[model samples]
Target: MTSPDEPHDVSSGVSSGAPATGAHGLGPHVVGTRVVVRRLVPGETGPTGGPAFTDVLGVAETWWPDLVVRREDGTAVTVPHALIVSGKPVPPRASRLQHVPGGEVQRRVRGLWPGETAALGDWLLQVSPPHEGRVRRRASSVLAYGSPDRPLGEALAAIQDWYAARDRRPELCVAVGSAEETALRAEGWTEPADFAGHAVAVQVGSVARLRRALGASPHTAATGTVATEHGPVAGAAPDVERVRVSVTASGDRIATGLADLRGDWACVHDVRTDAAYRRTGLARRIVAGLLDEVAERGVTTVVLHVLTTNDPALALYAGLGFEEHHTATYLGPPR
Candidate 1:
């Protein structure tokens, strides 16, 4: 992943005889393994651009004339040789920064959708009557349950008893990878009849980095950014269509966005652009707009749920530095 410099040559590139000064000094360790590189700023770091040395994580793919690398989320960035400051090899994507399904991540995610929540041992139960056709909220929810260590049978029984009290059927948002398949099957917790074959992947990213990345995309910057939510993200699901566009100077609705803040963590939802305006980087602008809006309120982390089968959505989110948190599958509790 790295070659030597200083006392020795780290030349993964051909010998130019010189160290490639001015606009060509990217040594040679620019390709192969993952590396974090810092770029130099001319005058002041903040005002000129960002920092004196901005560190980016990605696998190096080119060297010399321009340094190119691919980010973990499938986005590629090229650094002009003039901006090269220093770089080093980093380990591959082994441990993920996104929290796992059964732990703190699950708890925080459940807290977002308020329903009466309870615990069957370590498992979480959410009971809320389906309202205004928000079926996800209405159905009884059992989360982080069905693991081997936890009592799957006890959880199933508890789910049945709890939902029965309210005359509702118990449904589950399961991270199957974390649970025992045998136990789930033995308990008869079958996948929902209307299962959409596809699943949703939770993604997270730093507010600041994403904001900068969004700024870097020329297409995204072509459109103006608008932020339309301030309080509790408009009560779960607000009238996204009715929300006024504050940033669009153009008469046409090029893009729209809204965000909800819960303490330091926030989720950006209902970001959309007119179908006619799809490929114009409107999606990036909307997301950046939401993140930029929330960053003003001291929000640090951003999250979203995208369908696993939606390749375009996955690529879009990943390119902005969002890492997958987990994928969830739904099931009907023991029938």
Candidate 2:
């Protein structure tokens, strides 16, 4: 679900060429989403009549009343409204996870948290108690992979001991509905902690999309694209090293995008543009450059966490085909 402010662009219902629009109209939101349709009952032969299900999994492209659909196997079938009896969109497919049981993806995101981690069975204790003013929940939370492989009570005891040693408190940074969150609650560690709120989204598209968006960027000339590990970024820590990929369409480093690569996924950290470069499509070019640079490493999925209130960032990402996967909020341990 999108934030109250960020309404998704999916069609609510679709209208295809007659037969005629259904009483409720086929949900346009159904377009782009998978759906199953049952054509008018077999008043005739060959499964055409009598409430039969066309369990065909395909993306609805248009509902000109003639619902055009694209299938996974690169096949397209147009379902005319006349043939429709009933249909509805199904849940979106998840080939990625940054939510509950986000599993491997969540594990990979550990790189972005900037902390020392200790392997405690299947979990990792992020030891970022207090260094400077960065005392917060993320740096001092347990990343639960599977189960600890240790007893629950023992795990809690060990966590408390470790945090006590660091003069900090133990906390879990698991996805809201994840088993780990539930596990922590069962142990009587149920104080709801708040970290800067964030939500993760998934987008499935080819490098072609990236190339197109990049091409449209204001300073997207071939020279605009820059690929390097040490590219200059705005507001970056002077001593912090990053694998920066950016674009300089207006010269003098106007736009940049940075990523933290982990195995197959790249956590896009910052995609920025100079004030004068705003609305000029430089940011898109930067993202394109960033993704194109990382694609060489077989990075297929790009993930990012954005503040729920960042409306502009949310819109920019949505236009790039990203869809909400899940959200995570930091929850502190019991006092």
Candidate 3:
């Protein structure tokens, strides 16, 4: 009898893709659509005819080496991987897979606490828990077998099963690292495109020197201060409520930056300059000064995020010795 949990076709009233009659005196079972079984040859010496391998499905809570298949009546069949027969491929639904935006990706991430998704372009990628200290994701059209003895067909089917459960396409998947990459490539899975690497480095010793360099620049000194009818002020004058400012050469008030000291790290935040003084290397000077201040405080590292598409800003940071650590991608359901 079909299990109550399984969905049945209402019009035909068939469980899984099983037919009305079959050789086991039960019912005609559709080969690939309804139930998948392991095929065992008579001379096969392995666990080919024993049980299904549910572990291959990659379900979060499922144990390893267990068989999992649907019966004609819609009940789950648990057997060794060796017992199942390889079936034809069932194409995935194209509408379910989609490319999501960064905002949507952020919303989804916020919906789940402590879980993160990175957005790179329009693709949002969710990483699985760290395996061997490095995070990994299930690549599309790839299967991970715990052992080398498992049949290739069964491994492929297991990969398909994972995609079905996730409502995702398996053809566009990728695995990280040389080992996993090698395994997938061996199974004929496509590899991701090679790209330049990125890194982030901090200059702990040059912070003060950088600050002096900027402060000594005539352009920075002239534009760094507020101008009054009397004369130009050299540095910012601190006030209680808000930093006081005077109108500038371009009728804009001079802006200021503050150093946020935290546990051997100084974040140079709230950097601003007069409208007429913009792009005069003032910001870089401020950052350098801030870096110097932080280094004096025993800080050795600095980090920040910039939009990947911001070419000018990225170029500046690259020149300053920062490198890309990782790239993020955002994904959404198909439109």
Candidate 4:
């Protein structure tokens, strides 16, 4: 049975170009995700005079003998699995925080790295000591966000000139799939082959959730010690609170991480687990310790960055309830 609340004719429903099953197919995997399902409506006729089919759009609540969906309006729709002819999981709706200005996010994340920064209107250029004859993207890329208060060509030229004068290859870091990245591409900027798989995923979540994942109450008292430091951006005003956490066993450091608090926001970075201790839960301890320290300081939100290709790190953060807020990739000079 299709929910009468949101049923449309099959003629305008299923896409003719694609298979009845969605790109990822329809099955148990789609439960708990927003999905659209098309099912036949007996005794009703569609616009084409054929048997009527109705489409249900909502979060898939259950997928077994029947598919249950909860619509945005708080209504639940149950459709028998035998009647579903087409369905697919769709991307989730944007969270309220997703609408925050990209530039602000760039500042919050990239600002955690040590660097000398120069501003170009709304854009920020940062430079740090070179490593292995190359600069880490976060340490030396132009953070391409809002308008540069100049023509696109002029901004590009300035970025090039600035880096060239510094004897460094120019790079522009932009939110992947953003208009800014697309615009730069049209101007010939390309992702360097060497950086092919280096896209970074910026993730955010609640501190309480991470604490829960640590097998403790969300409001557990802070434990361990945290050392405070100043903001990494040279000449910038110090952040409200910056702290580092380390996990040691037998007087040897096995893992460490840092968090910087800006008002109510905190960003976690520089997390590392000794290669020998990988998968030992030390990383989670480091994060949990950091969360404990920051939570006492009134920080409720936490953010972190993970390499898209690092399956372990991705899984670690996801398991702690972090969701990808955006992805960033560096664009190199025109080919």
Candidate 5:
């Protein structure tokens, strides 16, 4: 995860203080970790007129007499130990659902509200008061994804202490079935009673596809003027990350959706329609308007965090060509 407090260090090279050759900064210790290795390609010549060198990115499967790497496509490549020139551990690849890594999306999402964020290695500890008369779990919870960069027990203790100082309950936003979730479970951490067994899927789709689907569906092409407003939201800076689109008919607002744009991606959330306007295709118009707005700003993809149990919402997004990329569960402190 990229910390809100600092940039991620993704430099790959020979491990610090290691030689330029032999073992190539790899050992039995790195066998199970993701890595990139630079090795000599036998019988090949380089542009420099020397022996060719190729870099392979994958998990280090073995480091005995020979080094074996398992690539993202699930193929294993073996390199002679004598052929290795340099290597180092690398971060895991992005999940299938991620157009950009989820951590990056979370970072941008956190920017929706002005707040203080501290880093526990790559994990982010968010600090803020409740907004709009509600305690947004994402605002109050620790983003316990990626690595803590410390012992699990130590990280957990720090998290609890950090929240305790603020007189707040400790909560964790962790990817479902992730190592962090498993470790937290083992340490007595569990979901809050209200959220037990519930998870939110982060679904993503292309802006072009969504706009096409919405435009092609006569049911969604409702007759209403869409008003787009861009400015501060939840008290963040003005004209930055916030956008709200609504459908108004006869001077009455009937449907609306919100989006927070960051770089090339935008997240749509809090969509709603008046009960009287339900099934009138106003919701689709609002969504389509939001998509069109973001697309004008050069955002190619849109994201939504929908509950796994939200059948209607899931069906709606599926119809728009969105696919589930990953899911997250909220874990509260151990009782």
Candidate 6:
């Protein structure tokens, strides 16, 4: 059975780093203790010809392990318990310098080549093999540096070193302003796109007005409903009783939008109007109402992802003052 603390990886062996050590000492290794795997950092084969694990850490959810670390910079890495080695207590800071799951360091470090060194900060670097260069290139991601203590140049240098180590090139580097971009451009990186700005606006007043607007408008055309004694009625909508709103006579729904508390941003997903009510301003009303609901929650900023080709929807969102913050496009190799 899998332990709750060991991190698991399918392509590699289990992580055997000690758990009890802290930033200053070697961690402990348990022979059969259960552990939740936090992450599988890349490792090198040992001189003796066996797999040598480096920078792996696990924790027991119930107890405070020797060290506690968070993904300080937003990035994602896979973590499973099976990657941990049994029979060892984790040290406080065994893998303090290692990348956190989803952290910018880990995301960018994957692209480093064997002889190259990926610089994460003034003191941190990730070194990998040249044979895995392609894998490392795809692993590059953007990271935000907000610390006043760290200069932009220092951060960029660290990231460059990391990419260099992985035999990959950093495509684009974003910092606070043009100065940072200019600095990177001077270092042989070209600008592929312009920096896009985003706006945040809050809706004001009672949600009733927006809800009423949604019902009064005619965008709910695609919605299907069962015919009842009175008229067409859509099936039960998702449970959203907390916010104040009323369903329209045509079974149109208006309620507080859903929020994804797991991430930093909140989204109002899949707002639609009946097909028969096309172009009558119903969709706008629903969106306006949702904006009001979000504003009432004291959330000034809202974000939603839409396909770039979706012109009409993009126009509507743009009319509401939402500008593109950033964009990602997928490309396949030439046929």
Per residue, candidate 1 scores C-alpha lDDT tens digits across 177-291 of: 7544445766777766555465667677778766765554332246554536344422343311112223353655556665656566765555666666565656655666677
Candidate 3 regions off by >4 Å?
1-220, 226-261, 266-275, 329-335
The alpha-carbon lDDT assigned to residue 126 of candidate 5 equals 82
lDDT tens digits, residue span 108-192, model 5: 6666655667899989998776654566677677988789979988998998899888877888888888888898899898888
Best by TM-score: 5
TM-score of each: 0.62, 0.57, 0.29, 0.64, 0.66, 0.29
Worst 10 residues of 5 by lDDT: 1-10
> What lDDT does model 3 reach?
0.33
lDDT of 2 by residue, 1-335 (tens): 11211122211123443333666356554554566666643444455444554545555655665776655553557777777767777664554333434645556565545556787888888765343345644446777657886898888888888878877666665666777778777766664434334433423334444445334333244446554574322332233234676666545776666765545566665577767656555555566666766676666666666655555565456445455665555545566
The 10-residue segment with the lowest total lDDT in model 2:
1-10
Tell me the deviation in Å of residue 101 in model 1.
Answer: 6.4
Give lDDT: candidate 5, residue 93: 50
**Predicted candidate 6: what Cα RMSD to the true structure?**
24.9
Per-residue lDDT tens digits for candidate 3, residues 1-335, read 10111011111112344332212222222221223333444443556665433211110111123333333222344543334444322231121112332233222222221223333333233323332343222211222212223454464455455556655433322213324335555665552322113211111212332333233222234454432121111221121011111324454455444443434433333345545555454544445545545555665444333434434344334333333433332111122
For model 6, the local distance difference test gives 0.33
Which one wins by lDDT: 4 or 5? 5
lDDT, residue 31, model 3: 21
Residue 171 CA displacement from its true place in model 4, Å = 0.9
Check candidate 5 and list the clashing pairs: none
lDDT values, one for every candidate: 0.58, 0.56, 0.33, 0.67, 0.70, 0.33
TM-score comparison, 2 vs 5, better candidate? 5
Cα lDDT for residue 26, candidate 4: 75
- Predicted candidate 6 versus true structure: per-residue lDDT over 1-335, tens digit per residue: 10110011101111345344333322333221223333323476656776654443332211123322111121112333344332244333322222222223222222221233333442233332322122222223333222313665665565555556555544432332434344555655543332122211211122332233223333232333211111111221122112222225444542212222111123443444444543444444556555555455554444444444444445344333343444332111111
Give one digit per residue, the lDDT tens place, for model 4 in 29-103: 555457888888878998999989998876665555567776655466888766777888777556556676666
Ordering by TM-score: 5, 4, 1, 2, 6, 3
